[model samples]
Target: MEPSNDIKGLIRQSPPVDVSKPYDASTLKGKTIVITGGANGLGSFMVREWASHGANIIVGDVDDTAGEQLVASLTAQYPDSAFAFQHCDVTDWDSQVSLFEMAVNVSPHGGIDIVVPNAGIILPDASIQFEEPVLKNGRLPKPNTKQFDVNITGATYTTHLALYWLPQSGSSPRDRCLLLVGSLASLCPFPTQTMYTMSKHAILGLFRTLRSTAFRNGVRVNMITPYYVSKSNMLKLPVEAAFLSGTAGGATIEDVIDAATRLIADEDIAGRALCIGPKLKSAGVHGVEDEDDLMAVQERENNGQGRAVWECYAGDYDNVDAFVKRYILLLNAAERVKGWFGIVTDIWSMLRRK
Candidate 1:
């Protein structure tokens, strides 16, 4: 897709990532991060990784026992890092509000630098066959939408809170980011998992829309769309069957973590989506005539390794509508107007009042 006219300069395709290169994970030190559904699976792993880097982490999850254990482990491993766990039911607004409040209260800076709306659910019996039972007495029964409530509604609540709190975070604008967790289902069709598919698709839509405008809030928004990972309970029999039938294997937890780490560590990266799947040799740059030739060149330039993480939808921001272009232009103009003169005028006004 062509770059949107308004975001022409602001948005560009992400450069090919070199996973083998070393990154100073310490760059995340002292930042306050809040994550929902962080008791197990990917969320739990992220908590450990971020804490190891010295980030103050607040995890909210419904699993009290697991969440407490995770927090205790991290606290013991990194005594210098602040770690807390709060009981949260993402489907409820009050619960989520309390979770955010707790995060701020425990934060070393009293503000949140990052928010991960990672809470999601997929019921084994979520499909229409189980949820949409036959009508009784000519009246249709209510279908179960718990999947929607947790995945879509919960994510929406988290996003709303992030927008309200992230700007107020003491951290610089470059540090303020929202990392959303989507699924391969967001892009592909899941025939039997109707609710799960719908919820993920909704998240994809949310990510795309926010990426186009999140810059206005100085919050970088990115997404991770992982193919089925064998570790999660959400990956039911149907998912496994599909994977077995296909030539490709399922993704691994390490692969997902690798992708997540890249997004979290790179401050300049914004409005990008990373898809994590089975590991494969790096394709090298998109039009290289010889794989061996490209690999040799890449090795000389920067030692490279095979990668499972690939960028998707990197150009959605380019070529936007006229309204967006005008809006961006106005913002740029306003910034330019608020130069040194604006600062001086504010100082003079304060002196006169004094």
Candidate 2:
């Protein structure tokens, strides 16, 4: 898919932030934050911020040396508070689960207050800048296996493990969150950073799916797609590194940091991207209009008896509208059949077992 125009449009529309007031840190007090990839970059920064605000922290990272050092520093600083570190490979489900279990063991009174699945890496070919590349411009060297393992699979595993290990999935009013570290790539096309972009976009979709599927379970999921977190692997190139590189301008490390913090504070926002930059208010991400429109269409269909389906199958509607209606009808019919089949299968299986 040609990502040039799409990425350009998204970057032009930066994340919108409410800079009317500074973020309140009091909300984090007494909370327990579990951060994957807590050793460095934005994840580490978040850990420190949460810890300073009286939140207990469980730092999970593959870099044991750096991770342990951060923990030691926090432990010394917050002698009265709780802080610990665990060596974890976020790509591995078992390792992520172990991290969650460890967090629970440490904080029995409170389950994981918030989970930040922030571990990610840039593609290998994209990792090297264009100073004197052996390969031609615009074309990356090769596929990056490490990027896929760490960015895509790693982020997915971390989120699921957090939900599984933590006692946050319920109908209670308790505040529990799963924040995925998505990228601007998730919103639009990123030409060269194939693996990185693929992973990020997939993570965004995963978060959205989990949000709807786990709504009854009370597992709130969200994502933050910073344009270019400074001094990090997310953006090793200059601002004009790629064709859609204009979005990198004016974005700094501080911008991404503030944006992430603001995301955590804004409880009303979810299932949307937040393009963070140096200033809090300058951030502008996509809204829920598309999703809302789709939902509204579905509700209309379900409210009226399969008429929407008939209209769709009749093929008299406009292209987009007809496609949507037909898709919804097919989905509804499939769901009905599946539900009945499930009931019958369950009964048969029970009888056989007996």
Candidate 3:
């Protein structure tokens, strides 16, 4: 007889996160975390919050002044924990590899437990556009790769390093995670920044791809998609503010941080993503009021109460075709066999060490 929840096993994914539930923050204690773009903006905020909870944090950024100063303050505030800074220009391969090496050397456990690819660049660029072709000397201008290079290429480099280091580093399920930070542009289009929007959308693709097989390496892959959010003071920049003005509610930095906190703290949440945005009230015209109210379209009608985070893209595999279902089932079967093989290998290694 077919099992009641056969598809659940086939998917090989953790259940949807219950945001109302609580998790242990001290789980992060002594866990070494390496983050890119940690010198300023959202990365800096996360570094501060995580450090307070006793996690060892290694920050990598191009801003030498800000990165060094942030590390100095963290060292003072959390003397018992670990904090290190490495000058990493994400666009450069050697710079990032050096950053990873520094993390391993300075980590309290001599390994990285969590890796967050948290660096991104978003500028009002009409270079990859048509309204203004940006002709150079009355000719077509070359399309710059700034947005793709940083947001896409740089992030992929971080992911490559994490895949190499995390499996050897983690001791348990709670100890391994590759947390990706995608932006509001990941879901929808932006006006002037075509490349920025496209790059964030590519993040969604990366998340899906990794989640499918990253678990075989003993690492959990998760992503956070935050809505139009202001970083530090971006009054001088035109992109962030322009988008929020048209949206129903603007996502607060606090909410974005909160969303990421949930994913990082909850070890059981694998292959899941949380979308953070301005909290809008639940609408009144619903049959089942909160069935899938986390989606933005559902919140568009009402304006009373609100929430910061919601589980987004939870239905990707929920509805699939026959070929996909069969393929996933085969993959799950192989994983089961491999799981048993890995258990034997681990037992043998432990006895050998003794």
Candidate 4:
């Protein structure tokens, strides 16, 4: 028999997010969120927005000066809201553990609702001399792997901890989530920045695999992949040069914040990924034309003004391989059998220890 044309079983289509529409910001109120590398750049931007919406935030970063300054400013502005800064080196596991402990200690409810593994770095020297050999006794020197350490290992540590703590803190399973920050490099290879590209690809892989089964743990997993962002006036020349050379325009910090807010505020969304790029004034959605009728309808609804956020391949989980499908089914079956008895026993054990 000929192969069927139905791939929907393996990958379901994801609904497009209406960026022009506003989400309920009130959903973030009173939630305690932990963000790694929340001292500057996109992390700082998210911190301000989440705090403005009444979320208590714990920012972890190695930049003590910037972290302290940011915490002070936010604390003063939102006096009733909790804001804390802890020194965190993502490359170090112990440092991350300490940061999580501090976050829980500072939280009013003694629990963490959301965790954002946003810490990342791209060293200039590492990228510049990625393949250059250091001549020492004619032996090939060990290539620098700090980029992987911070981007992959650090993210892994955060993921492990988030799985443990998020469930412990929330009264409802819907409140638990892990938000991973990836880059356009996650989807496409950047030859100039090999280490950075490799690291992001690893993160994208983690996001894909984790989302497939995170629901079994009652945890929601979402990710945001952003294109180059030109924030400073000094960087505009290079950004313009890239644009002139046929490269796509960079996304804005506001665009990223908007995408992230939607994920944080909406509890029904899970196993989703959003890619943020430059805004466009076209009447049609870019890069999605598999369904001509649906695209035409979307174009009519949008009219013009193409949004920066687009859903990535989020349906792959719907039709997973046999192993994954069986694993998820087995987990669901076990949960049904265990029921409240397991939960009660676990609670009782906790209470007795306390």
lDDT for each candidate structure? 0.79, 0.62, 0.79, 0.78
Query: How well is each residue in 1-354 modelled by candidate 1, as lDDT tens digits?
Result: 953244435533345455566666677899889999999988998888888889999999999999999999999998987899999999999999999899888988788988999999888575755545787799776778898999999999999999988888464444788999999899897777888999999999999878766777778888999987766655666766765575567677877876887787788777888888765554455665363323323333323544567677665544445444465476675443233324447668999994
Tell me each candidate's RMSD, in Å, in order: 8.8, 12.7, 7.3, 8.0
Pull out the clashing pairs in model 4: 10-319
lDDT of 4 by residue, 235-291 (tens): 357644664366556788888998998987877667788888886444444644554
**CA lDDT for candidate 1:** 0.79
- Over 1-354, each residue of candidate 2 has an lDDT whose tens digit, in order, gives 722212212112222334334768667776677888889877888888777878888989989999999999998998767888999988788888888888877763557777888888875465344223465586656533687788878887877776675455333345666777777777676666666777778877776556444444555565677666556544445543652354434355655665566656555544444555433221122443344221122223323321110000111111233344465586674443223224447667999994
TM-scores of all models?
Answer: 0.78, 0.67, 0.82, 0.78
Question: Could you tell which candidate, 2 or 3, scores higher by TM-score?
Answer: 3
Candidate 4, superposed: residue stretches over 4 Å from native: 1-16, 132-137, 170-174, 232-246, 280-303, 321-354
Candidate scoring better on TM-score of 1 and 2: 1
What's the lDDT for residue 314 in model 3?
Answer: 76
Clashes in each model (backbone N, CA, C under 3 Å)?
Answer: 7, 8, 0, 1
Candidate 1 has its poorest 10 consecutive residues by lDDT at: 293-302
lDDT of 4 at 152: 94
Q: Over 4 Å off in model 1, which ranges? A: 1-6, 11-22, 128-139, 171-174, 236-247, 281-306, 321-354
